[model samples]
Target: MKGIAFDALVDLFPGLGGWHYVPVPTEVRDAIGGHTTRGLIPVRAAIGTTAWDTSLQPMGDGSHFIALKAAVRRAEGITVGDRVTVTVSRR
Candidate 1:
């Protein structure tokens, strides 16, 4: 399998109780084509060296992204707009 990694900024979703995320790039989406189920895609996501099992969720604009919970951010020492190298693989 091909390695998937890319830089993205941490984004915030207002009015959703402080939900934060990192938008998955198109390349990642294309690499895992048609793997979504009910708007969520299961994957093993990693930030730097911390790996976790998470789901990529769809946004209203026909795009998909991954949620970066506070724990992950804190563990990775990253904040919004901070470029992060995210890697994902099929779960």
Candidate 2:
């Protein structure tokens, strides 16, 4: 249940072969903010539910933490420190 960072997200892009370059989108690029500490996190389930869970997979190693800006819109019941699932609305 760890959040991904920009460094990680970069690797998960479409293409990576030689002469192949699937660049990061503007939304993701803007969200990264040039750092690399944060990433595009996708919440698994409804927040505040006991069955909440999360995971993080590295996409790339940018050598630093990336700053991300995104909004969250949850319709389920959740609370701070409740350890519920979360989702980012806009990046």
TM-scores for all candidates: the values are: 0.86, 0.20
- Candidate 1 Cα misplacement greater than 4 A, ranges: 35-38
Q: Given candidate 2, what's the lDDT at residue 35?
A: 32
lDDT of 1 by residue, 1-91 (tens): 2358888888888885777898887668778763443478788888977888898888867678899977888898988778888988877
Candidate 2 residue-wise lDDT, 1-91, digit = tens: 2322221221122354322112333344344243343454433322223223332222465332112211121433322222222222222
Off by over 4 Å in 2: 1-18, 35-91
Q: Which lDDT value does model 1 have at 32?
A: 73
Could you report the Cα RMSD, in angstroms, for every candidate shown? Answer: 2.4, 13.5
Model 1: lDDT of residue 15? 80
Minimum summed lDDT over a 10-residue window in model 1 is located at 29-38
